[model samples]
Target: GGGWCSSDETCTYRLTNGLGSSKYYNETVFFGEIKSTNKTVNPDFYNWNRIVVEYCDSSSFMGKANHPKIISRGAQIFYAVMEELLEKGMASAKN
Candidate 1:
């Protein structure tokens, strides 16, 4: 089966494009459900401050490749994001 980038060649291609990088990301994005601003639609989580972590590593947040060309640090990214969130009130969240 084909994956996002099966080989170094394809991964290199992804690295240059928007798939493995965030250089072409938009400044704003809107999500539904928990991240939604509509209280009627989101109900429980509408008023909570939300963040949308961009998936730019192309490794499903589980890779830690030490390649010379491609810097696949998905695990590090996940932990860093979690730490930041914890520092920013998530440590006190009941749910």
Candidate 2:
């Protein structure tokens, strides 16, 4: 009725944060490996949902006395994994 999927289940994800405070020129890097336990369904079903990675910075030369700037990065590998699952026709699109 409201959200797409219920929280009745949990997913496992491995991630890396390579954006190691490159304040000299504002640089960031990250990657993740995600897997779901709902083996009954295919990975392609999670296409609509995404893992949003956010970054914040404040109390800096530019962020001084201001709210931390926020940026969101989306998942990349998930879709590729999903595409592969769909090829087998075992995956379905989810809202």
Q: Per model, how many backbone clashes are there?
A: 0, 0
Could you give candidate 1's per-residue lDDT for residues 2-89 as a string of tens digits? 2457688988888665577788667878778778889899998888787888764777777888888988888999999999999998
| Local distance difference test values of all predictions, in order | 0.79, 0.31
How does model 2 fare in lDDT? 0.31
Candidate maximizing lDDT: 1
Residue-wise C-alpha lDDT for candidate 2, range 3-91, written one tens digit per residue: 12112121001112212122333344332334333434445443344433223221111222211333222233345455667775646
Query: What TM-score would every model get versus the actual structure?
Result: 0.80, 0.20
TM-score of decoy 1: 0.80
The ten-residue window of minimal lDDT in model 2 covers 6-15
